[model samples]
Target: MTYSPATQDQLLAIRVNAGIADLAASERFSAAEPDMVEAIVEGIGAFAAGEWAPLNRVGDLEGAKLENGVVRLPGGFAEAYADYVAQGWNAIAGPAEFGGQGLPFTLACNVLENLGTANMAFSLLPMLSVGAIEALEHHGSEAQKAAYLPKLVSGEWSGTMNLTEPQAGSDLGALRTAATPIESGEHAGKYRIAGQKIFITFGEHDLAENIIHLVLARLPDAPEGSRGISLFLVPKYHVNDDGSLGPKNDVRCVSLEHKLGINASPTCVMSYGDNGECIGELVGAENRGLMAMFTMMNNARINVGNQGVQIGERATQAALAYARERVQSARAGSPDKTPVAIIEHPDVRRMLLRMKALTEGARALLYYTAGQVDRGTLGDEAADRRGDVLVPLIKAWGTDVGVEVASLGVQVHGGMGFIEETGAAQHYRDVRIAPIYEGTNGIQAADLVMRKLGLENGAVFAALMADIARDATSDEPTLAALANDCAAVGEWMRDTASLDDRLAGSVPFCTMSAVAVAGWQLLRQLRAVESGEAPGLAAAKRASVRFFLDRLVAEAAGLKASAMAGAEPLYALTSEQLAG
Candidate 1:
């Protein structure tokens, strides 16, 4: 549903008064561009409310079917996709020369949030296409762009990134896919890709003309591991120089997976070059596929984080609506009285509040990160640096919180929530995938530890802490303490003599960072209340921040202890001890 202008304005004002709006003004997030934000909000909101919502239940129930090697989407999906392409939704953020709107990624993030909330299964196809388009645009030759960009941008066809092989999984070094140079006339300088890629989304869908598959393979003579990898654009149908469809390529979908969620989207196991002639063109320099594909994956990671926030928001809305209407037990003292709505109960209120806090906090964090990316687009180096630091934090932390928040939504509905009819159960099921995909949360923690902690020699993180410390300055003693705690931890990281030892504390450091950032935003939100917006708004912000610090920040201590424990103890658990 389209949220009222009043509501949007209110949220914006609250964010603004709290200094959150300053995030965009700080040139950290470019979505602050009024036109871009409005266009994204409007287009995504309309598409979400109209096409996607109506099909969500159908997609879940009917799902997708694979027969005779082709997967058929649920009824109404094709029509929906056609409408999506007709509206140029797929082109909103692509390069302008390719017939796209050429909007910044911040707006795209907003649109993706809506898509995920409305129906993630349907949205993934376009999302994946966007990723592939980005890879091609950045590294493809002029001829390649002219041939493929128009169709991709117009959504006449779609795209896929094939990286996860059955044996490879997360270890690109173990990838066994091969790319041998062709020895023929028309396909001279081309390669023949031969490998099986697993878990390829939209591998055999019929919504588009010809799927552009970005395959990662190693040339026969190339050195092993990630260094020898190369990216190839292998379309389902070969394209003539005139951009007309030619012979069918040999990429085939072997089968589809039965997944826990997003079932409407096919997860196919694709076999390339079974016929020994899947003609492929290299995207960038050979032996640099991993680097080329990484740009797309990083973008996807942030988008996945946004999906988590969207699902959480949807769950919260559903739970709040249900609680306000469903009657339950009356107050204990009110003897012989009729039962009241669960919303009237203190415990229920607490659960709802907890859900709201988690969802809102996650949303703020995600949106702030989106805004940062937008700022980066505007050529602000500091904003770009900050965005880099926040990306992993937002992705890992936001997705983790999405699962928790969705579960809490289920909890609010009690036994009814356990049933499929409640819909809250679906949100829980859907969001569980977020933390697992786009690299697991633990992986993110390790990245934060080994990689991000060392960024700019810790200056970027220190600046973030300084911002939190500034916001935490207040008359409230608890807030003041929180500010001090944030500042202390930041200083500790900055002053530590052992960089590796400090880096060892990345997990704890990230936890503290979450606390610091959330607290910073909440205080900003609290100021919105002070500015005479809604009294409840500011009060809720204060209470939530207080609850977060009081209930959650203590984990920082435990994390810090673990961080200080060093690598040896953490890795010391043997197989024999583990068996016991």
Candidate 2:
């Protein structure tokens, strides 16, 4: 199926309904006029469809190759990346003082959705760069920002986050990378970083002139565990005093992993200071690397959530297209009649609607979260708190839905879906990593229940529930009921006596929260439709909301029950019994 970007009307409808347009118009984003935002969205959509979509298959087929410590991307990748940068797409939401266009992040989210939908693997390069940009913007020294921000914002030099190591995946406390302070010479006060970082996305890609790595390493004499870690700005090539590239640093791409999907994006094992000369400057204060890295990780979590929405949308579109063309047996009630397109089959229709409902629901929640991020910048403490609360939900639930929708897409294709030629399986493979990428969904759930719940002495979570409750009082009955159920679940979470109980049901609790939040967003969209917004799409919007409430929202109750079941039964099975 040919890819289709979200219509301008649809995008505007979401932005307006979510209040993102108003937020953009505020002092925090005075430069982001609605017309300009629309124009930018239109331009990015066109570029994504024209330049990026066609390369998805080629990237998957050819993948990336590693040779002589350098990584080579698939054909057309470099050209596409160059076009992406030259057009200033990379600077859409960047710091205005550092060569960025200074647009609202909401618009950036839309552009990212379009790009990710076109080609997830190819889209990852810029995605990681944005995270790196956020970290440096928040923590880098003035000199460091001046040296790297322009190139990074301009896309002349890409950026990466080097966190995961051979011995550490999610446990930053267990990392062993070393960063010794240099006391003399031109690089005095800098640290010589030496370590092996694995699973570094775009770590060694040849898409740009240079790559900036935000590495996490422990300083000598520092305390043990994550508190001792510090962030460093490590460049692949050393920079001269005049801002020109110098000799290669003691950093190399030791190898690339052969992954199940996203073959076009190189996942490298990076070696730093192998020869003991890889100099890096500190970002933020010393012995606070994990805190600094969290800035990037939080940003990345949201982008990864958007990836879920993007892949789900793409997969659903493809499935719908296939269903409309693939002929099968006659409709259930008319077996003697002529065979019709699979779309005519009730079951097939159900699957397609499931995909549509999940994809749109996820999109609504993600877009709303992006709006909260924009509002948070304006010193809206509530919005900032809300953004933090929603991060895990957006990442975990969105990606889980993305995976589920992609799987349903494959099911809709039947035997043909299993064939690589059909491309349905590729969506499944590509989306499979999102849940595990930023932080595993399991980790996201744990964070949601353990950490975020404690914010403001639980007042933050209560306010969230209150907001949903207020919205649930709408005339729509199902929406109201779902909202009430969500509130009840929240109450149970608050009253639960044991952390073990919460942990036991953390995943389900997160899922229930996600469904309830998506339902709230859908309710808002339905109201917008009733008010004649996107008149032509109103009927479809209503159907989607109904489908979501009836089909998906019903799962919330069962999830709540499972959450309340506690950890006893979960631990009932011993290791040997589980193996049996």
Which residue runs does candidate 2 get wrong by more than 4 Å? 9-13
lDDT of each: 0.75, 0.87
- Cα-based TM-score, every candidate: 0.89, 0.98
Score candidate 1 by lDDT.
0.75
The residue-by-residue lDDT of candidate 1 on 10-62, one tens digit each, is 24422442233444464334344655555557666777768887787778777
| Best-performing candidate as measured by TM-score | 2
Clashes of 1: 6
- The true-versus-predicted C-alpha distance at residue 568 of model 1, in Å, is 4.8
**Model 2, 360-469: lDDT tens per residue?**
88988888888888788788899899989899999999999999999999999999999989999999999999999889999999998888987887788777767877
Q: Give model 2's TM-score versus the native structure.
A: 0.98
In candidate 2, list every pair of residues with a backbone clash: none
